[model samples]
Target: MVFSNKQLLQKALEENGTALTIVELSQKTQLQVAKIRQTLTTWEKDIVRIGPQTYDLKWRVYCGKTFRHTPQAIEIEKGILSTETDVYYYLIASFDYRAKITLYDEDDVAYPLTDRKQSKNLKLSYLSGLSKWFKKYNFEVNDDILFTCKDIKTHEFKIRRQKKQERDEFIIAAKNRRLADLVYDIINHTLPKQEGDMFLIRKYVYVYPFNDPVPPDGLIKVLANNKRFLISNIDKMYSWTGHRIKDFLTVGLRKYYLQNDKKDWIPVIIDTDEFGKYGYCSQCSERVIWESDIGWHHTKTDFESAESYIPNEFFTSDNSKTRMN
Candidate 1:
């Protein structure tokens, strides 16, 4: 039976519990060596590199969860003690939510510097209080010490802080104006015509009124509704925004569509002749194409009457409507 990249990855992870080498994963999944390498790279954001040439199977479970664990690395040169201290200070200030900070003496082991100080483990509360310390000292932390945390929590905290910083930066760049105007500017600049043009922009913010979950029914409602959007916008908003669109339709908009009976879930865009003439190739064929094409192909349409499901706004221009007609 055939399996998608997602499915194959899931299977490989399930079969091999913690970490898996690239060679072992390729052999077990029967996937091309190159494809396995590519998948490993794509999955790196979600997976943890336990050792050299080994990846932990975390992506399958924590696909896109906010608190998912990721990997991070910090390097410091020898003799740069001040620089290392400053790095730790900044890290604690930035990620007190999910990271625990600790300070080690010159001996490479942690010990309380003062009698009043609690155990060596730095708590969230202490890290949160760092801003006050920085303001009082007029200088940053030293740079020679090593700091570590629970890998997953550290990753999650970094992701959250980075996202917040990015959103704030965008809002500041956009002159702290309304989201609607930002959206308008983005749409205008990115897709001037909105044909097949696609691009992704990171760092977006949104605002919604607070009182009601559905953002007041009418225009005259007032509440402190605000939401921040931050993601690399892919061309055709549906690629990333589609998930948001789906959520809106189900929960916010109360609209739903029946699922099609076909096995594939992804929407396709291609002509009938193209699909028919190039139905996916069977294995052992003399195609000489890349190994990555193992399970990628256009799905066959069952000749059902195609519906005009494209949004009405997409046809605002008379010329576009005429072409569709």
Candidate 2:
């Protein structure tokens, strides 16, 4: 039922199409002509004067990924080339009609964008002169060329090479999409072996030695919320670095056992939660294991912990306390 003066003006202009005369905007917005005129000056850059008492809020946006030049034509996606396919639809509908198309740089200077699939289809034109422009700008293959277009009668386009810090910003975006996976890989393989499953990803790079530039925010987000990791405490997160730990209670502790000092099979305790299972092994003289069966290989002299092999005293706390070694 109500709107701020700025909101009303913006709503009216948006509903009325690209450009609207002051009277039409005022009537739609329910604002007086003098008030609209006075408010227009404050939005100088956003509101443009294309004709008498007419204002337009320009639509300028980057068209596609900024790409380096190659011999092959730029592959622009259909939806991207222009938001409104009015021009394309018209061209297709009227086969005999001819239309003038042009591309403009920031300067008012216009170039013929009218070219066919084969050659210099762009107006004021880039074929032979494109190289000269690149030379003048000193752009590189890694540099990004931002492509944007303004709201105007014809095709109003701009192509400019990002410089210095601006180029860094573009590169950072690419790192977000691509380098994040590399960071994830590094985290996956070296984990559970590193400082026991608890460390900040950003600090991990600095704490440990690595060549990769510290992972960007994107990489951090992926590694932090991954499902493979069990988040012990969201308030105080730590990695599950003890998967392959030497201790008896560690989960998945058998990627491999830490080599035991004892060379022969001896007595050991297998802790299957409450069901106490005792066994023998060359791996360790006497140890408590969480896994009931570790699947060790042995002969009868090698085969340890058979059902009949247990001495009744072996269950006694007194005998269990004694170490054979």
Candidate 3:
């Protein structure tokens, strides 16, 4: 299998006591001098380029371990030719210790800046000036900077995923609104100011201020539930019936009832022939008993203390059969 030429070169250098020239490395690895020079420039962290064609493993040291001013190193130190990510990568690779790193976007206000007067001759823009400022600050770069990049990438992905999920949930909620809530929304917002009969059909469900007649699916159910109106021949649009006089009274009462209670605005009185005499309490499921025979003639306050209603938090830890306390 083909192997990494860079790895092979570093292994050869490690084996030798201190250093090797380009010709020596070419002979040892059986590679061409041209290939050796390209590899040396790319893998400068692995082998310190000592001369035009000579090299030494970066770990190797003589008496005092002095720095080598190689032609490539000199070019890099002068900032004549080097990219920012490349500079960061080289520093982290060269240093053995961990270091904290912070990354800033080009437009971020937190990034360091140099005086425009000082940088005008160099023609350094805000972004380019950051690199020069970093060097002047004597900041030690290390491997942790790569970890910071990974952390930023992961956080950005989570933010995007979360936003998408929230948008999906909002779309679902709008599409699947409860029938009761939809009716409430219409009465509160869309029923129009100047009124004759406001007829609603499936097409005009929320497309309010419309006079057209087309039965939308679930609209008949809303009409039937409102006790003020008597419904007959529900399936047949032409034969459908309503008591206009009763609707006028109930619709007005409903406006007042809704102000106090947000629940469905059903009046306490209605035709005995249509809706039977027995009305079940929502909380208890027992027949709601009216204190006076008159029924809805009294306000909502009269029914608040009725015995038929169930108490709040009905569940008890004691037994299976539900009982009111």
In order of listing, the candidates' clash counts read 23, 13, 1
Better of 1 and 2 by lDDT: 2
Q: Each model's TM-score?
A: 0.24, 0.24, 0.22
Candidate-wise lDDT, in order: 0.28, 0.36, 0.32
Candidate 3 per-residue C-alpha lDDT over 1-325 given as tens digits, one digit per residue, 9 for 90 to 100: 6757787788788887667888888898998888877776632444656544667654342111111011123222432222221222222233321323333342332332222322445432111233442343332321011111223111110000011222243432333233334444433343221111222222122222111121111223333444322222221111102122332111121321111132233322211333333333322223434432122222245454343232222212111111111
In terms of TM-score, which candidate is stronger, 1 or 3?
A: 1
Off by over 4 Å in 3: 61-325
Clashes of 2: 13
lDDT agreement of model 3 with the native: 0.32
Model 2 Cα lDDT, one tens digit per residue, 1-325 = 7787767877877777667788888888889999887776622334544445776663311122122211212212110122011122221111212434444445555544433333354322122224434555665544444443343334444556555355354545444444334333433454242222222232222222122332223222322333222222221221132122332111111211222333321223233323344443423344322232332333233233333233344333121111121
* Per-residue lDDT of model 1, residues 184-282, tens digit only: 334434321111111111111111211121111111011012111211111112221223222111101000111123321222221224223121122
* Residue 271 miss distance in model 2 (angstroms): 46
Say which prediction, candidate 2 or candidate 3, comes out ahead on TM-score. 2
Error of 2 at 49 (Å): 26
- RMSD in Å for model 3: 32.5
